[model samples]
Target: LNLVDLRLTGTIPPALGKLSQLRRLALHINALSGTLPPELSGLSQLEYINIYDNKISGTIPSELGALSQLKELGLDHNALSGSVPKELNKLNKLQLSACELGGT
Candidate 1:
């Protein structure tokens, strides 16, 4: 529940997926818009997720690969589109860095 860059707006409150021992969730550079709440893949002790520079759009939520202890996934900038959910490559401790979609 780090709530980084607290310019937060709205959306993303799917009850925080019931916080199943939530590990790290930094709402980066906020003004949070819509999409990206696949029940947060039920958390499952999420490792790190920084919703970078917000204005969130759609796609990229293939149930977040069910988290399986996600390493790092910061969706860079925003206005996300499609094509990125090959089940997140099964997360093998994913290191997606800054997932740039539209812009900053």
Candidate 2:
């Protein structure tokens, strides 16, 4: 689903995780907040995820590495912490801010 630049607010609905065949998710340039749902690991077919430029926080879920099909991840300009899970080394593209580089 592509919800980019829609000015969306509030937290991402965790139920979205149930879309097991989802290939791409775009929720960028919004006001959405809160941590990314670890449940999203259920999206086994997910190839791209772009939740950039939002108010989301928390560490990048290690569970996301289970998205073996994930090739692109756009997570810059938010409030995330922690070192990116080594499992994400499989990604083809990754976006992150300087703060994220210095995070715990």
Which 10-residue window in model 2 sums to the lowest lDDT? 95-104
Residues 1-104 of candidate 1 have per-residue lDDT tens digits of: 89778787989998898899989998988899998889988889988888878888877778888777887787877877766777677554443334444322
Best candidate (score: lDDT): 2
25-45: candidate 2 lDDT, tens digit per residue: 999999999999999999999
Give the TM-scores of the predictions, in the order they appear. Answer: 0.29, 0.93
Error of 1 at 7 (Å): 8.8
**Backbone clashes, each candidate:** 0, 0
lDDT for position 92 in model 1: 42
Q: After superposing candidate 2, which stretches have Cα over 4 Å from the reference?
A: 98-104
